[model samples]
Target chain A: MLKINSVGLTISAVPLLNNITIDCPRGSVTALMGPNGAGKTSLLKVISGEHKASQGEVEINRQSREDWKPAEIAQFMAVLPQSSTLEFSFTSEEVVALGRTPHATGTVRDAEIITAALAKVDASYLAQRSFVQLSGGEKQRVQLARVLAQIWDHCECEGDASTDGILLLDEPSAAFDLAHQLMLIEIVQQISARGVTVVMVMHDLNLAAKCADQMVFMNCGHCTAVGTVSELLTPELIKKVFSVDAEVITHPVQGTPMVVV
Target chain B: MKVLNTRLITPRLCGLLLLIALPMVSLLGLMTGPVFISLADILSITLSGNGGNSQEKLIIEIIRLPRVILSLLVGSLLATCGALLQGLFRNPLADPALIGVSAGASVGASLVIVFGSMLTANGLLLGLSAISVGAFAGAIITSVIIFRLATSPQGTSVATMLLAGIAISALAGAATNTLSYLADNDMLRRISLWQMGNLQGASWDRVGLCAVTAGFLGLLIPREARALNAILLGESEARHLGVNVEWLKRRLIIYSALGVAISVAVAGVIAFVGLMVPHVIRLLVGPDHRALLPLSALAGAILLVAADALARVVIPPAELPVGVVTALLGAPFFLWLLVVQRRRT
Candidate 1:
C-alpha cells in the first residue's frame, strides 16, 4: 500500500497542494479526478518522489519515501506524465530500454527487457520506429511501457509481500482515442489485479467512473471527496469539484456510475 | 531489429584498448615530427634508455613526447568537457568554451607574451598561469550568472539557458576585442598566436596538472550519466524519476567548467574538438551518456593527436597552429552535417 501523509506543496508562493493525504492499497485502482489547477499532477509528483513537500512524508509499504535510495525508490514507484519531449531519434525500443537503466547490468538483458516491454504495451510495431516521429498517443503508450518496464524490473513481489509496485500517471489518456483510453484503463486494471497499487489523474469522469474502484475529487488544491465511484461521483460533487454542472447516472450494462457532461 | 550487445566486453577491456591505442597514436605523433627518428633509433632508445644518438633521443623524448602527450590530455579534457556541457545544457551545440573560458584564457596568455618582457624572464609560465586562472574564473562567473538569469522562480528552461549563453558569449567577445585594441604591436602578435591556439609549449608538468583535473572530472561526470539520461526527457519528467534537477545542474556546470578551464590553460583554445567528437559519438552510439562520455574522450584524444600530427607535417618545419587544423577539419564536416540535416528535414 502507498500512503501520502500530511503532504503539502508550494510553487512560487502559491500553494498547489496543501496538507493533502491519499492512499492507494494493493489490488485497487484509485482515480484522482479534478478540475484544472487542482493540484492533481502535483500530488502525483509528490507520490513519485519528484517534488519534496514543504512538510509531509510519503510512505510506500510502511517505509518513508526519504529512506529509500533513488534506485530503490524508482524500483517501487513509476510515473508517466502527459507528454514527453524526446529530442533524440532513438528507436522506440531504445527509449524503452532506458526503463531498465537502474536494473540491467548488461546491454543484452536490457534489450530483452525493452523487447518485452514493447510487447506489453502492444507497441511492438513501434520498436524500430524513431520515438521523435511517434504520434502523441503512441508516445504516451511508449512512456507507459517504459515505466511499466521499470516497475517490473525493480519490484520484489516474491514471498508474502502481497504489495508489488506503485504507479502514478497524470492524464495518461488525455490524447488517447476512446479505444486507446479504454485499453489504458484495462491495462491499469490488470496491473491492480496483479496486486500493484495504481493512482491515476484522469479528466474523463465517465472513464474514471468505469475503471476506478475508488475516486478522489480534488478542487482548489484540496481533495473534496474520496469514496467508491457510486457513492462519491454525484452530480453535486461534479458541480463542486469542477465548476461545471453534470448529470450523474448509472451505466445500464455494468451498474456503475456514469457522468453525462 | 537486433540490439548490439556490448556487455561481454568489460569496461576494463575497453580501457585497455584505449590505453594501448592512445600510446600508439602518441608514438606515431612523436615519430612524425620535423626531424623524424627512424624505427631502429626509436627501438634502440626504448631498449637501452639511450639510442647512442643524443639528437634523436632529445627529439623523440624531450620535444616530441611532451607535445604529443599534451595534445592527448588537452583533447581528452576538451572532449570530456564538451560531453558534460552538452548533457548539462541538453544542447548538442553547447561546448566548454561557449561561456568565454577560451577567450579569457587567450587574453591571459596574450598579456603574458606581450607584456612579459617588462615582468620577468619566465613570462610564458606566468602568462599561462594567469590565463588559466582567469579563464577558470571567467567561465565559472559566466555560467553562474547565466544559470541565475535564465532560471525563473519556477524552473530552468533550456531555451532560456541557451539564449543566456549566447548573450554572455557576445559579451566575452566584446571584452576580448577591447583587450586586443588596447594591446601594443608585440602584445597583438602574442594575442594572435594564443588565439590561433598551439601545443608548442607542451611540458610534462602542464600535462600532469591537466591530466589530474580532466581525469577527475571525466570520471566524475559519467557517474551522473544516469541522471543526465533522465534529464534528456525534460526537467519536470526527470524530477518525476526522482532526480534532484537543480543539484544535478549545479554540479555538472562546476565539473564541466573546471575541465574546460584546465584544458584551455594548458593548450591555448583548441576549438571544435569538443563539439565534433561528442556529436560523432552520439551518432555512433545512442545519447546514453554512459557510452557517449567515455567514448568521446577516446575519440577526442585520437582526433586531436591526429590533427596535431597533421599540423606538424602539413607545413613541415613551419608548423601551423593546431586550432587552424581542427577548424579546417571540423568546418567542412559541420557543413556536411547541415546539408544532411536539411535533407532530412
Candidate 2:
C-alpha cells in the first residue's frame, strides 16, 4: 500500500498541496481528478519521489520512502509523465530496453521480459521503428511498454490482499485516440489485478467512470471528495469541481455512473 | 535472437589491441626516417648497449620516434575527449573546442612568444606550457559558465547551450587576435604556425606526458558509457533510471577537459577531429555509447594519421599543417550530411 500522511507541499511560497492524506490501496484503480490549477500532478510526483512533500511522510509497504534507494524504489514503482521529449533517435525496442536498466545484469532473461512488455502493449510491430519518428500516440504506448517492463517480474505481491508495488501515471490517455485509451485502461486494470496499486491523473471523467473503482477530486490543492465513482461523481460535485454542467447518469451498458452534458 | 549481433567486441579488447598496435606503428614510424637504418641496426641499438653507428642511432632513436608517438597519443586523447563531450551534452555537434579551449591556449602561447624571448632565452617552451595551463583553466571556467546558463527547471536547452559556446568562443577569438597583432615578425611567424598546429615539435618528454594522460582518459570514458547512454533520455529521465546525473556530468566534464587540455598543450589547435570523428562514428554505429566511444577513438586515430601523412606529402619539405587537412575533409563531410538529411525529408 502507498500511504500519504498529512502531506503538504509548497512551491515558491504557494501551497500546491496542503495537508493531503490518502492511500492508494493495492489492486485498486484510483482516478485523481482536479481542475487545471489543482495539485494533481504535484501529488503524483510526490508519490513517485520526483518531489518531496514539505511536512509529511510517504510510506510504501510499511517502509518510509526515504529508506529505499532510488533504484530500489524504481523496482517497486513505475511512473509515466504526461509527455516526454526524446533527445536522440532510439528504436521502440531500445526505448523499452532502457526500462530494464535497473534490472539488467547482462542476462538473457531480462531481454525476454522486455520483449514480453512490448508484446503486452501491442508495440512489437514498432520495435524496429525509431521512437523519434513515431506519432505522439504511438510514443505514449512505447512509454507505457517501458513502465510495464519495470513491473513485469515484480513478485512481492499476488493480489489485492498484498501491498507492495504502485504504478503512477499523469494523464496517461490524454492525447490517445479512443482505441489506445481503452487499451491503456485495460492495461491498468490488468496491472491492478496482479496487486499493483494504480493511481493516475485523468481528464476524461467517462474513462475514469469506466475504469476506476475509486475517485479522488481536488480543487485548489484541497481534496473535495473521495469515494466510489457512483457515490462521488454526482452532478453537484461535477459542477463544483470542474465547473461543467453535466448530468450524472448511469451508463446504459455498464451501469456505472457517468457524467454527460 | 540477438538484435545487435555484428560482434560483441568489448571496449577492453579494443583497448588491448590498440596498446599493442600503436607502439608497433610508432616503431615503424621511427625506422622510416630521412636516413635508412637496417632492421638489424635498429634492433641492436634498441636492445644491445652499443650504438654501432652514432649517426644512425641519433636519427632512429631521437628524431622520428617522439614525433610519431606524440601524434598517436594526441590523436587518441583529442578523439576520446570529443566523444565524452558529445555524450555529456547529448548532442553530436559538440566538441572539445566548443568552450574556447583552443583559442585560450593560443592566446597564452602567443603572449609568451611575443614578450618572453626579449626577457629570457628559450622562453618558447615555457610559453607553450603557460598556454596549455591557461587553456585548461579557461576551458573549465567557460564550460562551467555555459553549463549554469543552459541548465534550468525546464532542463538542458541545447540551442541556448550552443549559442553560449559560440559567444564565449568569439570573445576568446577577439583576445587571441589582439595578442596576434602585437607580436613581432619572427614571433608572429612561429606563433601563427603553432596556432595552425604541428607534430614537428614532438619530443620524448612531451610524448611520455601526453601518452600517459591520454591513456588514462581513454580508458576512463568507456567505463561510463552506460551512464552516458542513460543521459541521452534527459537528466531527469536518467535520474529515474538510477543514474546520479549531476555526478556523471561533473565527471565527464573534468575527464574530457583533462584530455583536451593535454592535446592542446602538445599540439596547437587541431580542429574538426573532435567534432567530425564522433559524429561519423555515431552514424555508423548507433548512439549506444558502449560502441561509439572506443570506435570513435580508433576512427580518430586513423583519421589523424591519414591527415598527418597527407600533411607530410602534400607540399613535400615545406609541410602543410595537419589542421588544414582535417578542416578540408570535415567541411565536405558536414555538407554531404546536410544534403543527405534534406533529400530524405
Best-fitting candidate, measured by DockQ? 2
Give one digit per residue, the lDDT tens place, for model 1 in B225-297. Answer: 8888878877766665667787888787778767776777667788899888887667545577887788888
lDDT of 1 by residue, A111-158 (tens): 777787788777898887767778888898899888887776433233
List ranges where model 2 is wrong by over 4 Å: A155-163, B1-60, B118-128, B144-167, B334-345
Across A1-261, the per-residue lDDT of candidate 2 in tens digits comes to 888898888878999998888887777889999899899999998887777888898988888977877777776678888897776666788788888776655658767877888887778888877677788888988988887776766522364223356788889997789988898888888777777888999999999888897899998998888899888888899999999888988878888887888
CAPRI docking class of candidate 1? acceptable
RMSD of each: 4.1, 4.4
lDDT of 2 at B133: 53
Docking class of 2: acceptable
Candidate 2 displacement at residue B258 in angstroms: 1.4
All candidates' chain B TM-scores are 0.85, 0.79
Clashing residue pairs for model 1? none
* TM-scores of all candidate predictions against the true structure: 0.86, 0.85
